[model samples]
Target: MDDLVTLWPSAREASEAEDVPRRVMITGSEGYIGSVLVAKLLDGGFDVVGLDTGYYRAGWLYNDGKDRPRLLARDVRSLCAEDFEGIDAVVHLAELSNDPLGAHDVRNTYEINHRASVAIACNAKLSGVRRFVYTSSCSVYGAAGDDMVNEESTPRPQTAYARCKTLVERDLMRLADVDFSPTFLRNATAFGVSPRMRFDIVLNNLAGLAWTTRRIAMTSDGRPWRPIVHVEDICDAIQATLNAPRGAVAGEIFNVGTDSNNYRVSEIADAVAQVFPESEITFGDTAGDNRSYRVSFEKIRRHLPGFRCAWDVHRGARQLRALFEHVGLTEEMFLAPPYTRLRELRRLVESRQIDSDFRWRCHDFS
Candidate 1:
């Protein structure tokens, strides 16, 4: 299983048949999705460097140092050319992440999500790396109404975090003057557990609510269709980007997910209840952020048709339920004031746990 993660195409298959061995950098390496990605990259044989501040807590990256080429503990603001000195591609995943969390500190979200991202792009260019991937979200599509969104869809980011992602994407595109090989993945709402356990995502939250209260809360009518992907498939998408031809991905945006992964919130609640059997599912009158619509993964899959999606939502929720049980999560897990309220990036600043001006240095782009 590990051997397959780093598998590269043959030299003759490289279109140009060049001999540049791929070396990739994954930021946010310790987060929920990133940690799983790190494992895949290492097992696939890519010289992978994981750059993270370890903000997701200690257990988040327990697998680090075992398989990755390197892991750097540093803030994004401190990223410089030397940081990416020998890297080939950059997967930028560092962010304040999502609406509830961003609402905690809009300023912190903007600074880290946009400003620091632009800095990373510049460094990637300076360090001579070609491919650059920014992990954007389908939430940038805002309230989809009933529209089926493709890459051509104009982003209507509805939250502080979504808007911040849109802004960074713009900055990265602007630097196309440097001929940066930019690939934007407006990923679907991601779920499933990783080394970093986030109870915040929909499926995880629903499973948690089901476990404790026997009822999963629906913020709204729960009728909006949402695209979701398991963490493993997201890693596959990143690996696909890493190996795709330079011309195939340069200056392009692809919605990364599976068509079949789309599900209504009410549907997700129902699935969770069915999987657990003992849990009861309930719904609300409406959704909180007012965002809904299914996203198409055709662009990415058609381009890289060989890519595979292994985990579906039903199986994914069951996997998460077992994980929650294994972790011994308590009712107070989400009941605490702010960590419970949501991860407050701004309060992180006030608490001085975050060092904003800490010289964002480069880790792996040359």
Candidate 2:
């Protein structure tokens, strides 16, 4: 925290030094979204400190068997209360990630996703951090009932991942009283080649299946409406928030994706098929199962004022095909042991493959 205060002019310039430019502390800094977000923040001239306890190491795309970024490997939970110094704001991107991983240990999910989050927020606020940007998920607004779901729509979270994000969103509203301008960024399901590549997302997964298996499977009937955005776009939205005029963003909840980006899983698959000509596609039987709704992105655009997204699903798919070829991932190459098998996080823990303090938070929450 001394580093943050040092930027201020001498005591003679009290008012000038009072409002410091944002020095962002990005937890989960090396993960799928966090790593991309880090680069964006750095490029945008924000002094950034990254924290990542590499529990899931495969998702890191920036690691080129060479020098990596200046990310401290520390568990979010293990962060000393004193560790909160010099931070101007926080972009909390660390968590158990998705449903399957959260399900591996519900307790681990709640503790890390919920408890640890509150801890970070509390510490950061106590340490005089001003803005808190949390990367939430639109999945909390589950199984939408109409043509489109907007911010006013009720969030019906069905899984632990969605539920945890919703819980954080709720709590963030209260952080306003602590002088922390908390903003909830409910992002759409991200898919694309980012500094940290995630083949787990829908479009990326389909591209993977198409590339290796020559087939893509759809169980959500290919009819469910899903709001999709590229990872870069999501990071761009976060960058827009740093020291933004408080009214447009402070203590606000905005759905972060473009209206033009929602696509039917089937439509997306077909699009990917066209992009990857060798692929065959098949739709599964649950067409009427009802977890579908287009999302209205006008609220964020008109209100946030400066918000914009680059790379819709179509552009993201092409990038994935290129990444696949570059990585030399072939049909004979099954996903890395930890790629598809999320439970391997446990074995990763035992092997000391990552910082163990994080694994301590990985048990079943329920």
Candidate 3:
């Protein structure tokens, strides 16, 4: 009874300590999801410190007036334990983000996504950072047929990008302890507005094509299933995980999306076409892009009641159309490197802005 009374204030103090403004460090905070998430965290009163190699800073679609967080323009591979000092949590979003970029150089994908990510998490754990929120992807469930897969389902990651996600998730789990809580948010395909927007994604690409070219089309048959969530809602999920009780999120894996948001590529094209009446729809098998998965988001809903997907495909399409109309999106801009991750990375490589390892190359002006 005396011991219980003595421990009560310490426990209460710890809980109250967490209630104060948290200092969160987000890697890849200049990219698509990272940009929006930084703003959302700041608006939610988190003290945000952003770190990025600035691979896509020139890829701005528009000015949203969301100021960049206190930033460190450094590569994730170079992150040391000292970087985690004074940080309450670390949101790991840095990577070779998609299939095309992964396909471009499989070795680099494994290096940055798999190896570097695990290294960062290990450092965070060593530095005593309590919460590590990994922005994993449903792409890890590559080619999961008609059945809806959940956190327990066997991951069948097909591409190098997806394979790295599974590897990182597995590696991070090994570091989880009472003092270090790691949460893997296997996010569905992300869409909707962001200051650093990506049109390489299905819905965003189709919307861009429809608005700029007046045509909605696909290089594949458009049958692949993809569950999507809005960028803001993804931010919501991250924030929830950051503030969630340690017991609730410790080493937990949650599919970050709504079940109903899953759609076939053709369905997404149709939604975009509906938004732009003048746009014609086209489909063909230019390539065998067989990746498909229907994800179950029930775990997050049940575990983290505060996390909910607030955007659907139709709503996201409408939002994109409005943004495109407001900006007077041109075909040239739509097809530019700024809107596509793979293209932008390619451009950076060609110009020697970044080297083969995707590290920024220092200019030799002297």
TM-score of 1: 0.86
Model 3: lowest-lDDT 10 consecutive positions: 4-13
Candidate 3 C-alpha lDDT tens digits along 44-120: 77789999988888878889987678999899999889989988789999998998889889999999999999999
lDDT of each candidate versus the true structure: 0.75, 0.75, 0.87
Name every residue pair that clashes in candidate 3: none
Model 3 ranges with Cα > 4 A deviation:
1-15, 18-21, 364-366
Candidate whose lDDT is highest: 3
Model 3 lDDT vs. the true structure?
0.87
lDDT of 3 at 314: 94
Candidate 1 residues 1-366, lDDT tens each? Answer: 223323547323443545233678889887777778888877776778888876655344123344545788888888889888877788999887778877766777778888999899899889887778899999888888766888898888878999998888888888775356788988888788776667678887888888877788877788888888888888888878777666767788888888888888888888888887887767777636688877878888777665767888899888877776776656776433232225533344456665553223344657
Clashes of 2: 9
